[model samples]
Target chain A: MADSFSLMQEQYAKILQTYLQEKNEIGLYHAQQFSKKVLENQISPEEVVSLHLDAIEKFFPDLPQGARDSFEFLLEVMMGYGMAYREHQSLRDKQKELETEINVAANMQQTFLPKEIPSVDSLDVGVISVPASKMSGDYYHFVKDENNCIGVAIADIIGKGVPAALCMSMIKYAMDSLPEQRLQPGALLENLNRVVEQNVASNMFITMMYGSYDPRVHHFYYSGAGHEPGFYYNYKTDSFEELYAKGLVLGITRDTTFREYHKKVEPGDFIVLLSDGVTECRTDEGFIEREELTRFIHQYKHLPAQEIVNNVFYQLEKLQGFQLRDDFSLIILRRKV
Target chain B: MSVQSNVEVRTEWGIVSARQAGRNLAKEIGFSSVDQARITTAISELARNIYLYAEKGEIIIEAVEEIHSTGVKHGIKITAKDKGPGIKNIRQVMEDGFTTSGGLGAGLPGVKRLMDEFDIDSVAGEGTEITTIKWNS
Candidate 1:
């Protein structure tokens, strides 16, 4: 460090001498080149000022005390600037590290989702989950067991980034261990709530909606844990009804009970399950009402289940200026038989 | 005597600065470590709310003194003000498990729980201002 400082001092002195003698563009060009060299060596602005002062003192031993005092003040100002610049650089590095970790966590989260949406003879299903950021706090899973009961679960962690991703993995493993509960939406939620309460932090919680559709019975049994209400489209009434269930969010308590609800599905009936991102979509006006969301669904109800979700997502995405404010997850299960 | 600090909350760094300013004021006011943590946490939530929803805002931390019939009470007050798109439904946002940000829905309610006194004023398209105080007991 001392050797580089001395070398830089020598170069600075030479540039100063040339600038004072010629006072032309050639001297200015050399000064710029010297600055580039100093930057490459990571010499701070204060250090450069110090080197300049050294050169000035050497060149003029009888320089006025007032002139020297100004140099000292300039040195102090440069020192503060240098410190702030270094601090900013370190903060940028930390932010980059955080971004990389989130990307890795996002990739790990992708594996937790169902690789393929299980095809059911009686149920036409479609799902779309998009994260506003690299790491998603929203999670969804599909389980098709031996009896061919299609179990679907959508959950949102009350947090974001790495911690949410870790909590999701825990939920995924906990759900996988409960094969019997898959057919019982309320029971599944009850067991998952226990896992969350025991494992996760007190400040963090998760809201989830889980449901299973039995093709044979044409019944969809669902449960919710403080989640946003979903919509149930009735073919007979040609209207939508809210799917509401009252329960505390998971991780709040170990003994909280989630109530089970069911709806009979006719040939043209469908169930729309979604995270709050769909219903609370913000635009120039404000949050879109649930009725507006239902209208979007009704408009695209004639298309295939997947097409409907995709189109709804596009419309909402457009409303928000093509930038989602939160993690968006939507699922539609239409009875085709 | 009242000492105030202002932090402009426009980015992640702004949230950090607001938290630091709140902690400093809380410490100077002789708040216990636990209370100081709570104050800082509340400030963090408010500052983050501005960064996320409002895009830009200001957080002011002030040492406050209130006089009552019994005695003089010392406390710290924090005010977060923003001119971004204001909340359309203040009641819904204050609910414990209602969040549009896909977060833990603990934003405003959590702040309320941490502080002794809380108040919020918002106008759609105008802006929002939240004032909260925690008295040393």
Candidate 2:
């Protein structure tokens, strides 16, 4: 095999030399070798072409810029394919890790969310929460203290991922550690804002909607922390009014003041506090028109809390070619005198 | 309503952004009393610990059978596990006002205080898992 390869190498070298010289006829050395391999005259044209390509690979001068560019493109294609394959593998690994982490975190976060709104003596409370992803930043909580006054809040942390989740931790701590739990909603937001600013990064923030209900008064007072304004449906007035408490988002301004807004919730009256996820929901038609959402709530003002939330989600889901880009959360509270 | 409910709590790093997620879930379920508040606090603190310290962890919440009939026997159990820089000293970490420059270490102690029962297992550089129970009354 070595001898034969050497012979072929010799032949190819001569052919290269002849090509370089621009000779029409085969060189002597090439002719002699070609004859030895095909003494019976069985040499095929394809063999000649194959031999010629090998010869060119060894001895051809550098290709022109255009030809070289094509070669580079071929290399690039190979590299691109390799990178794509690697990225797919990496994404799979990340996905598995994310899936596992999401499962864990979701569980932890879920424990904080109440299984059901406690049945206050004369108030009907129903709440629904859904995360935009495996994990989300939207949160709503209803805590009934010894006073039987329920403190309800729906908060949206700035940013997504682990950082926001951590902020929630600090917020919960401050809320839990408060020796004075019965402060006005504005004061509670004040303390929470300071705690969040002290703990969270400079870039992080949380938008929250908070309120307290005194069944005795049948009145609900609420405050907003840069979250969207909520709506109050008064059965007596047969109308809907917005709940807007002017306050800076937590972690943004410590000195910023928040005003507590109140609406007398009577029998058959309901308050709807929700994150921006619902209003910002995009549709083929457009982002959920704010007016339309308001109207939607007004239309179903008399429905039960669960039914109301379900209908909203149902509509959002049916939005053709629309997408839910954020976590949507809602809390419905009704006072039955 | 005398109904037995089950929930499992698990924690993982940067899993998602919506935190009050669990709180909302609790409201949807029937645990809306002091018991729910306790579990909710525990879950929040543990989850925050996982996010701030180890940069990652996982938790699972599931409903368990009822016991100790005082209020609602239905309760939620949380299991938080993470494989990030475990606590250097569990005792010190549990101490109030002894923050590790990573926000206040009010998490574990707070969690213990909030749960009907709280248990912790952790090793430095290994991981930590906190299991807690809250029974609705």
Candidate 3:
């Protein structure tokens, strides 16, 4: 009995030492646990308190009664401190749970993006999509229709993070369900807008550009929904022209009609599509003008389509000192006869 | 006028591009086959380091001309820079057998021995930059 009492005495001494040195919640938790253990061992609370006081008194043999009373008061306060520590631990655990949940959601968002660009006949396609953070507000998708015409869609969500990621996945599923609609850019955008208007939140909107290229006839059909204008490079003339259509952002108006534009793509000509993130890249002065981006396309017109996409992305990323503040996406389509 | 090419060393793709760019520039500078392999290997190591330690970085390949006391020397210089957690003990890190990532611990020392000139600049909490050169003999 005496031996077990001595061991319990030593355990309390160590707990008090830990609390004094580290002053952390873990140490206080240990103190509280030790006190409970003493009470369970048939020792009265007053006896447990006296035993702890005796241990400290052994270290300070000449301690005054006033000091002893204050030490006794501190022991009562330690009980309340332990309860607060337990609450803090639970809160920390909750925060960790939330962090892991966010990571899983981010990974789910990644799978919505196109795994690979389709190999279209007589056309070279290049795509570059970079998210500003773990979740992207920008989206790009590709679908090859029955007639071998490739359909391309580039979109930008109005916000970032989980909300944007969720909207993108919805867009992906909606587009997948309507593969036949890919042939007509106007109908495709209209169908997509209706889906967005009915399903997505009222405050949320999406800007998008959809196009289809028929390699046999070398004809391209495109439509936009308040998206940034893409450029067409005429290799023969060595000139660049912007492809524009009038429309409203999706989820804005149910009755909105998108204008479909058509152009005959000649051999060596290219079409460039990008989100506003690429056009609104911040510079020391301000946002870079869209004319500069077109000029870049004209300058690097000689390289392969993929190389041109890479070079332009590198130059834009460099302009912002390699830190992208928004989601950036660019797609290039070249007619290779 | 100077001709240079840059590849962002973000993944394996970047490493391959960096190595190809280095090898091509070395060939253009008229380096022998043995030197071309050495320069390409050095670029591979540096670019891999950026991808492993720093998530992303840039590799710049430039044509260099050095007017030394011996003669005018033409060469190719490759610079790899990244904004990442800089090496704390650079000297220790460069030792042949010391490694933090548990591979071979030979990347830095191997790069130093492969090139004619090697330099590294790093600041804790800031970033790291490594530059190497291969000269035509």
Candidate 4:
């Protein structure tokens, strides 16, 4: 550090001598080059001012005391700014480190999601999930039993970032361990609630919906944990109704009971499940009403289940001016008997 | 006594500056650490709203004193103004679990809860302005 300072000082002194003698652009150019070198050595502005003062004193020993004192005042002001600049640089480095770590966490969360949507003979299923940010606060899982009964679960964590990603992994493992409960949506939610209440923080809660489709009975049994209500389209009535189940969000209490509901599925009928990202989609005018969403669904209802979901998503995405504010996840199940 | 600070809300750094300014003013006004956090959190939400919705806006922080019948009260007032597309439905946005951004749906309602007084005026195309104040208790 001392060697660099002396080297810079010698160069600065030479520049000052030439600039004072000639007062030309060439001399000014050298001074600019010297300034660049000083910055490369991380020299503070106050230090540069001090070096200039020293150069002036060396050239003229009779320099006025008042003029020198004014330079000293400028040095003091630069010192405060110099300190703030250094602090700002350190903070920027820390922010970069944190962003890199979040990217890693986001990658790990992706692995926790279902690798492929499970194929069931009696059911045609379509699912789509998009995160508003790198880290998603929403998750979904699929399990297929020996009898071909497909269990589908969708959950939204009431938080964001790394913590939400971590909670999602825990939930995925917990559901994996409880294979027996998958066929029973009500029991599944009850067991998961206990797990969440025990492992998660008190302030953090999860809203979830679980459903199992039995092809033999053509019954769609489902349960909820304070999640958004899904829609049941009655082909006979050509109408839609809310699929409501009474329950509290997970992690709220040690022992919370979830009520199971069922609707017999007929050919051409379907069920729609989604996060608030779909139901509460917003545009410049206002939120997209639930009725409008139904109309959108009906328009594409004749298409394959997958096409239906994709088209609806594109429509809503466009309505929100191509920017989604929340994580969007939607699932559609149609019986193919 | 009134001391004011203005932060431009055009980028992420703007939101951070607004929060820091709010925290400093709240602390200077003799608020407890909890209240300081609340004030900063509210500032963050409001400032973020500006950046996300309007693309560019401003956050103004001021230390204010209110004269009441009982006594004089110290408080901090924050105003977030933007000329971007205004909110069309203030009532709907105020409900919990209502968010367009993939957040916790705790946008406007959360801000309202964090401060003592909240007022919002917005027109569909003209602009939007939100003012909130928290008194030191």
Candidate 5:
């Protein structure tokens, strides 16, 4: 009995040292369990020595079975805490990196988009393009080429992101090169389609609406390459006219032909161009339909060109449940007398 | 609730068309609005290479496991292969302003800088396969 008591004392002292060395409060909690074992005669002198050895192994924090036992389990809990802290820190770092990439990409895409419509006499124009991501696949541009031909395009690339941005650049350059393309919508689409097919992949395609407006005649000649129809409203008739001609998508098949549509805008006449993002928009009700869109346009017909554009976008934003799933693009042009 | 999914797109040109297809693929990958954009951007660059540089390829996107021992990232992996003109000098082609066609030359190099792991395999008169992986925290 005397020998056992003395050995237990030594073991207890050793365990206390481990708790201090490792600053393991949980270890201290388990030390009480060791003490109880002795009081209950559950631990023998040999077992006391083994417990002391375990305490020492855990002081270095590399005890393999260190955490399996009641005493070692406490120290293991502390180790878990430390590891979890490090893991959280690493995760935060990665999140920051992704955010930075998105910011830069979004900014680059923004530069490619037009912030404001060009100020043209006798023409009221407003446009909005929202990307489902930081960048989107839908591209719209308003350009007055070197020949002073106002070119407007609403193109939907087969996919989204930086690739769409790259493709948008391609479309801009191709249209610029074909400066002499006037009142020739079919030929213009043919040239653009050929360029896209040869330059891009055969599977990749673009559905675009390309048009050149002649300020002199107030006439718009437009070509469709599998794009959505544009609406032209004539105030004189108090009705809506459509500019839709069937054409194959660019890069689909090289020899695909395009159809041309012409419309003369009077002083109160206006034109609306949009990507499928608008027409295909969905909400809780169901897929946004074409007739519903016409109703929305007519509802806002009283507003000026820019105001109508803003109002239409506002309605779509609310109706689509505030989610811009695909690239949402819209352009409203009013002919000023 | 936000949902994320992992996808693998056959590097066929037909599948890549239609913005909805790519958009659906993006949403499935558990990407945030911003991550979705980066993912799409990365996909665009790689897909263009498959179509423009090679005749065919495949792209893989994987969702990262919450706890990974191998330190693997939770980003997408895109691999593309084509049997057209193999890049002669990878180093030169990796540089900006270096393009086989009259383009921005932002395809390969641009994708490399966007991801965590970027690899390439090519032989003259054969084809080229490029792989890129991005990570989410």
Candidate 6:
């Protein structure tokens, strides 16, 4: 009986509150009818006053009395709540629209990239890529020509998100437009620099390591523009070698030059290319040292290329507490022993 | 720090992957060879359930450690989740001889027997999630 009595009291308070908030005649009429029904149920006038006072205290503590009419004060408060609620609703809708647009852009960017890694009978290729968010700053591309010479390019932009995604697509289009110049690493970098300097924003830059492998000559000619130095594993010596080249980052200056270096490729030699994400992985103590990465590569060099990449990724993920702070891209090309 | 892995079970290959992942995590956490096989069989059963009922789902493998007044205990936890037709009568389904999809009907009961802890939550129209844990002595 007490529960039913309090339930009716609460319902009456809600109806009165809604009438004041919405200023609708139907709500006011409903409130009047319910109050009449409460009186008929033998609820005393003192009990009604107490229930109303409790509702007022809980819903509006700072309501001023006598300085302004109670109804007028409620009108002001209701208008404020209505405006704030509308603003919140509109902001939520705008956020949802923005998220949908970003998803669309991400899907469009994916279409501009290669669907799968190209197959070359002489090279066993494996790649692993993970973006830090919806978009990535790292780029890896493979271009094969009629003569079976393959061009391998890996790059990292300075920034992230939509701008970086756009810059990567621009680089892909530039590479696709110039297959004739693919064999010359130095000249190709120069022409790409000109394109970047003219087209890309002045504040942005890209670091790249581009190499051309000629299966017939068993040689890899490469150029680097302020990019990470890749490692080469020699099967006979069981040692890792770093391939270094000196050059300036692209989109910086028009006259900057890139120098090409050549290495003789042998059977069982593996080329490993990666962005700084691999080299800068963090641990409890500090960033993992470069020498540790070198030793890790040598330890897992005997595994299939894909397994080596996955093991490294999982180990690094474990070290970093299962989170990646930046975009990661790794490519391994091995000549079968 | 703990080690974890995930396998999506939609095909026979996925069941194999979940089984292998369970065995690997068990071995890493120092579970005995006998316990490793038990863990593998339990995960395979869960993965098979996903493939047969939901057609697609995921299995998560985790390495866990708990420390208290007694000492430290290391264990492995496997969780299987699916958005399929939820079980209507959980009590009847848990019986050893009851079969819904008509095999030996021993999967869930055997899973409960093999692990130290087993839990399941299901909503009639929503989905189901089952988790099991095994500890190393």
| DockQ of all candidate complexes | 0.01, 0.01, 0.01, 0.01, 0.02, 0.01
Per-residue CA lDDT of model 3 for A5-64, tens digit only, reads 667878777788777779999998897788678745644333455567867787668899
Q: Judged by lDDT relative to the true structure, which candidate is superior, 2 or 4?
A: 4
Candidate structures ordered by TM-score, highest first: 1, 4, 6, 3, 5, 2
Give the total clashing residue pairs for model 5: 9
* Regions more than 4 Å wrong, model 3: A1-92, A179-182, A295-301, B1-137
Cα DockQ of the candidate 2 complex: 0.01
Expressed as tens digits, the lDDT of each residue in A1-337 for candidate 1 is: 3347677888889889989988999999999898888867867566677788888999999999999878756764554345444444544666899788778878878988999999979889999999887778889999887788898999988766667778878888988887654458888899999999999989888999999999889999999999999999998899999988788899898898888888888999999999988887899999999999999999999999999999999999999999988889999999995
Tens digit per residue, CA lDDT, model 5, A1-337: 3336456656676767867878878878868787676746534233344455554664556755633355433432333232233333444566899789878877876776666666667677778788877777888877664555577888898777777767876776776688553546688789888889889866667899988777777888888998888888888988886768688889877898887777887888888899888888899877888878878888988777667777888898899778787788888878887
Model 4 TM-score? 0.59
Alpha-carbon local distance difference test for all models? 0.85, 0.68, 0.82, 0.84, 0.68, 0.79
For every model shown, what is its TM-score relative to the native structure? Answer: 0.60, 0.53, 0.54, 0.59, 0.54, 0.56
> Model 1: residues >4 Å from true position, as ranges?
A1-43, A48-69, A180-182, B1-137
Q: Give the distance in Å from residue A181's predicted Cα in candidate 3 to where it truly belongs.
A: 5.9
Clashes of each: 1, 52, 0, 5, 9, 0
Task: Give the per-residue Cα lDDT of candidate 5 at A188.
Answer: 79
What overall lDDT, based on C-alpha atoms, would model 2 receive against the true structure? 0.68
Q: In model 1 chain B, where is the ten-residue run with the lowest total lDDT?
A: B96-105
True contacts kept of each: 0.00, 0.00, 0.00, 0.00, 0.00, 0.00
Q: Which candidate is the best by TM-score?
A: 1
Screening candidate 5 with a backbone cut-off below 3 angstroms (N, C-alpha, C), the clashing residue pairs are: A122-A336, A203-B13, B4-B28, B4-B30, B5-B28, B5-B29, B5-B30, B54-B82, B75-B134
Local error of candidate 5 at residue A128 (angstroms): 1.1
Worst 10 residues of 5 chain B by lDDT: B1-10
